[model samples]
Target: MIQTLPLALPGALVDTHRIDLSALYSTGWGVEAHDVAVAPNGEVYALYGVHRYTHGVADDEADPATANLGYRIITRYAADGEVLASAVCCPSDGDGDDSAVVNGGEMTLCVLPDGTLAISARPDCTTLVAPDLGQVLAAYDSNDRRPFEKFTPGDAFASSISVTPSGRLLCVTTEYGVWKYGNTLANVVGVADGPLTPASKPVIEAIASLDPAPTRYGEDDRRDHVRYQGDPVGFDHRPRPALTERLAGEDRLAGWRDSRLGRPVPLADDLFVLPVYGRTFRGGSRGRPFVFALVDDQGAMTGRLGGMDAWDDSPFTGFCFNVASDPHRGRAFHLNRYGLYAWDSSGTLRARLGTDTKTFKPLSRFTLATCSPAGELLLVHTTQHLVLRVPTPDDLADLAPAVEQALRTYARQRTALKSRWSPVNWHWTHTTTVHHL
Candidate 1:
């Protein structure tokens, strides 16, 4: 089966701007950009997770007092890509240990209508931070306990947040459904309900069905040292399948899984687009996932794109589809390795722009991204420590060449990244102290 790219419709998205945040990542031991958002005014905000490892002691065994020490970093950048302000907030000291003193690692960000940054840093609460990074303006706690607090998976937890046109905050969960809260962060106004599909269940069971072949992958499996307290155990066979079988199962699931939303993109005050975030299964699994769904103000699905399908399977990051809407043009954009796809408000394909360049061996997959009113697409590549800006053009002819040029520009920017920096000084200057409420 030959993979075919999405048909180009009428409009195009061109790459024009780029920002490299590798400097900040180099400053910490295990710093990562968890999320990124672009404000209407062209300002960029990023959620950074700074990992601190106490080798001998686990996260729970570590001191709770220092749990919030250097964990969550939020940086604001100007339209020109200069670091404007950066702050440190929220605790990041939990790893599903029931006895863990602090459980506050997960976080996501979005800018509110009033020009304030809204952050769902903890599972139970969301905060409104002043643009100047001076203070936490207000906070809304759902008064609910997250599964992570109890060290177990449950119905759903906040995975990402966005602002609706009506000045309400939209919270997308890891599963279950999406929530709508007032801009004041006061109360839950509504919810769009849907349970997550057990998309990986079939693949998981196939892998589990394999016969136990000791030393197939490795001899001394690490389960004994990690799970059994060094007790000599039998052959570790659970979920241990042949490499070919595992790959085949994984590929099949990727192509045909039910739709899952990554983050909702508001195209207007009354319209939003939800990207179906997942990868394509290889081995001729012809199923094609829906690209995105258009929703009304009431969170009702109006239309969706299920026509496009890629020819080849390429590995993507945490979220396969990163979506953002250019409300000014009434268009929604979906980004992946295959291309950048655009759809009109009515869910019609408007354009398909490529991001391929020979300068980079493989194009970096951005984990988080957002669009500005001025038609700029801001992308955050966590592993690459890159914050990129690209211009969204309306014509494919213009976009095709611009894509190549912009990618080349990004290549140059990525190449200039230094290997290391002073963690202490970077934290002191770039991270503001926020009280853990």
Candidate 2:
């Protein structure tokens, strides 16, 4: 683990501390960390990589190959803050195999309670597994039944994966719908085919099911009738002499019409479908949406909280980019681009703090953000960082008695040692020595 010396504090200064994690890893240039997961034992795993695209060369042609090539990398840090392992996913440059170039983006990492690390890469739904330490595990894609068959023309990126309380894994993709698999990473493989449908197929069906069916080819019937529904013009049909003006005006009018009508319509029921976090058990409910449920290992719902809603008056929309549970306050704290917000375990919005007050400084330049399993907020914004501890009223109450005793002892010690060192005497006798003989 990386450590730094304590800073001299001003009067009544709160002790701000943060661990500089980059000091422990060799993160390459042009790479940015996307997400981080901390294990129960305090080990931190980060998902990060470079974004690029690779191209393919044509047959029988001497032309240079041109395709977008991207790289994905994953690294694991030990509990003590040492880089234990690292892995990258990239296209092979060998001459034998020729295929379309691959690309990856938007990575996420999660550590199972049993100590397995799950790293999910997006735009291509693949999960790399690192089950134990000291082993250089070769990265593998989630097993594809139709490995030879092309499902989508481009890459299928995996977005996020979360481990349920019962240990099952739930993963979502940019193109493929959400899926749940058995607790282990092996079970999650190929399970995507059994019950889940690819994202494209369902969308095509939904479009076909629209009431006013989309036309493949026909005359421009919808455009001819221009009903003057709003207001009547004061002047018309006066300037009909210039051909160039008419043609230019026609082009501008046509462009505006196309912009208004040519947009693709969204599928129905799309907005109501909430993104599932994971399938977990608490008491009674089974296979419930983790979005609005206080789920536990038994698939039962507990606590007074449910899923969070959009912040109606605020910009963040209430969905937290990162969240940490504070059992001491019975709440979960979140950090958005704006400020901090808190919700109860039941997913109820408890308080909107630090927005207007600015009691907590904004995260201006943090490279990585993590919440301690114990509920402290750690931000690695700079080479020198700051850690903010937000204690609830209950935390203060727990420390009340001890705080009083510690203050009394500090006052007694300070008074006893006040006159022991004099500034003038130290300057005059620079080589003064203590004599005990």
Candidate 3:
């Protein structure tokens, strides 16, 4: 039965639909939904990673041999929760070359204006899957680009990505900052910041482990870090092993694992917001607060939206995992240890809906959220293996007619660009990728 619950806000109800993911997380595997995105046509696409694990292993039984599985899979579902199609776009050889079969994190996904899907996995793997959800159409990774070739794997990773209404691709990386690429994933149009200051220790290890020296990629820097040419707009934008200390002897970690970057929320014009959070060792504090970096399709940082700060000593932690925006309402939604937060484009907090009590309990299980074309929210509850469809509350009323018209205008601009793109043949090589129709 599809379960429905009253949201903290009046006149709003949430529908919970459980997704049967048992097969993906059976005995020796740990699976997580990297991200969930809803297409304009009401189809849902979820990107998940099935990692390998061995528990209760007799200390010497050479872990039971397991079949090689693709590190990640993108599943499509109808609005009513019926499975539509699924395919493994990333292959793992268990050699950790192309994709990580285990211990991979920080992936993001978004549906392009042309109905295709774009997904990014850690260590620099970004692929565009066909609309039918059957194959990978094009791919970009550390192996294919120049600036990407010079840095360590983390430097090239696409922590977050969003396609502009004009069909440009905006991406955020660990070290190289943000980038703007052509929709075809063929060329880079811009860049921002100079790679993260002084690569971290882990990145150093990755550099030393590379064999035969990395090859160079030939591409001009082009329009690197063009200052935000668009008008000002509002938006908003962690991980740590502190789990061991908190859980004590529980033998398990509680709470959701946040990806490196939350899913990007598209806003007016060519702008989008990317949430940034991570652990900070300074002053012995646990983690950093969330910051919403507002950038346009040209890879320029326009403005930043602030989030909760730890110093406030508030009951809830200031960290957030993901953010979704309702461009129609000019509002953005952020999820954190506290609950779901709603903010306007000007960065004003309008509401904070707590899910820790009442009909909507256990906010900790929801790892991420994506807004649908119809203005509904698609949230993922990991612990329950469910997806919750949340309608906009009455309090989040529609924008003035003028503002609504502007949004419609922006969307129309996107639709006109769709003709520039046509589906490509599934020619990428992924020996282990399975097409699960």
> What is the per-residue lDDT of model 2 for residues 5-55, given as tens digits with 9 covering 90 to 100?
111111111111111222232421123445666676866655444332222
lDDT of 3 by residue, 283-364 (tens): 6433433356565544455665545554432222433356777766667776655556666766666666555544233454
lDDT of 3: 0.44
Regarding lDDT, does 1 or 3 come out ahead?
1
Residue 38, candidate 1: alpha-carbon lDDT: 70
Candidate lDDT scores, in order, read 0.45, 0.31, 0.44
Between prediction 1 and prediction 2, the one with superior lDDT is 1
Window of ten residues with lowest summed lDDT in model 3: 6-15
- Supply every candidate's count of residue pairs whose N, Cα or C atoms clash at under 3 angstroms: 5, 31, 4
List candidate 2 stretches off by more than 4 Å.
1-29, 51-70, 91-103, 131-149, 152-159, 173-320, 323-330, 355-358, 364-437
Query: What value does the lDDT take at residue 307 in candidate 3?
Result: 53
Ordered by lDDT, highest first, the candidates read: 1, 3, 2
* Model 3 quality (TM-score): 0.57
Clashing pairs in 3: 191-225, 236-292, 237-291, 237-292
Q: Residue 28 of model 1: what lDDT?
A: 32
Per-residue lDDT of candidate 1, residues 1-437 (tens digit): 00001111011100111112233434334555666777877777776655544345454554443232235666776666656666655444433332111234346677766687767644334466777666776554333333223323222223346655455444442211122121111111122222212121000001111112332122321112111122322244332332222333334554323323345666776676655433344543234434455655453556775446644422142234567777767777666665666677777776655446443323446532666667766665545456667776775336555555666676665544322222232221222233232
